[model samples]
Every structure is written in C-alpha cells, then in structure tokens.
Target: MDAVERLRRLCIDDPVDDAADDPGWSDALDAHTVSLVRIGALIATDAPAASMRSVIDEAVTAGASLQEIVAVLEGLIGDVGLPRTVAAAPRIAAALGHGDDLVTDAEI
Candidate 1:
C-alpha cells in the first residue's frame, strides 16, 4: 500500500496515546510524523500534486470545508508539537495548495 494508505491503516488500528503507552511511543510518533512529512513533500511535486489536489478538492467539494482541513492539519501539528509542525508546514501547504481553498486564510 501507499504511505497514505499505510498511515490510514495505522490510524485505524492503533490510536495514538502518549501517556498510556510505553517509553517508545514518542519515538514511534516521531517516526510516523517524519514519514508523513516526507509523503507531503513527495505529493507536492508537479506530477503528483495534481492528482493529490484533485482528490482533496473532491473531498472538500463533497462536504469537507477548508476549516475542517485546517483543523485536521492543526491536530496533527498539535500531536507532533510546534517545532516539528513548523518544519512540516511548508511542504504540507504546498501539497494542500493544489486542492482546496487552503492559502486563502492566514490560520494555516
């Protein structure tokens, strides 16, 4: 499966918990976030960006609004914290710019 599919399965199978889990939780979360950031960067490329944007735009057009997208992104950022999130934002923004009305608001 693709990284996004793998990530979806991971999310479905194992809900993240920093407190209840073992000491390795932080490392695992970091690894997962890094992988996602890489995927975001890859998706931002000219070839993949169009496809990715189309999917995201369809989702948004269906029911998901820009705020919802931003909330999901911010939640991911909250999970990973500011430093990592800040580092990941540009790539993610680039990727997201292809689809929904992402860059319109300053909140993202």
Candidate 2:
C-alpha cells in the first residue's frame, strides 16, 4: 500500500460504508479519478502539502489532467468549504510546477 492508503487506514475510526459501483453512473470513479479526489481530500484534511504534491504527480502519471485536478479542488469547495479549497491552492500550484504563483487565502 502507498503512503496515502496507509494513512487512510490508520486514521479511519470506523469502517467505510461500502457502496457497490453502479456502471450507469455518468462519472465513473476510476483509479485516476479516485486519486484526484483523494488528493483533494488530503489537502482539505491538513495532510502535508508535500503529500498533495506527491499525489498530484502520481495522478498525472496515471493520466489525470491538470484540469481534472482543479475540478476536484473546485468541487470540494461545497463539501469541504472555502478555506480547505483555499488551503489547497499553494500545494496544487507547487505540484503543477507553477510554484511561483502567489496563492491567497481565498485563491481557490
């Protein structure tokens, strides 16, 4: 298992509610998509910023695009709140090799 998976397993207090996959769902949750979302969740939950960078790199290597990463972060705003999205911007920027971008508190 990867570092993220290890952390997730170690941290979860309760069992995850198992949901069977629905093939008809428009947005299928493939490995890459799941990785993208995992990256965002890590960011929101105050995992190391470097962790986000690493996961972002892996996601890109796994065929996820920058747009997809941004979409994940954007989508997270509603569920995780503005601060979490804002907190993620710098990490995302560094991961994308645009580290010079000045990410503000509300940048996302």
Best by TM-score: 2
Q: List the residue pairs that clash in candidate 1.
A: none
> Candidate 2 — what's its lDDT?
0.72
lDDT of 1 by residue, 11-67 (tens): 798633443553333445454344344343433332244454555545444565556
RMSD to the hidden true structure, all candidates:
12.9, 8.7
lDDT, candidate 1, at 22 = 39
The TM-scores of all predictions, comma-separated, are 0.33, 0.64
Which 10 consecutive positions of candidate 2 have the poorest summed lDDT? 17-26
Q: Considering every candidate listed, which one attains the maximal lDDT?
A: 2
TM-score between candidate 2 and the true structure: 0.64
Give the per-residue lDDT of model 2 (tens digit) for 1-108: 344554485488632333234322224567686777678779679677678878888898889987888888888889889987777777788778876666644542
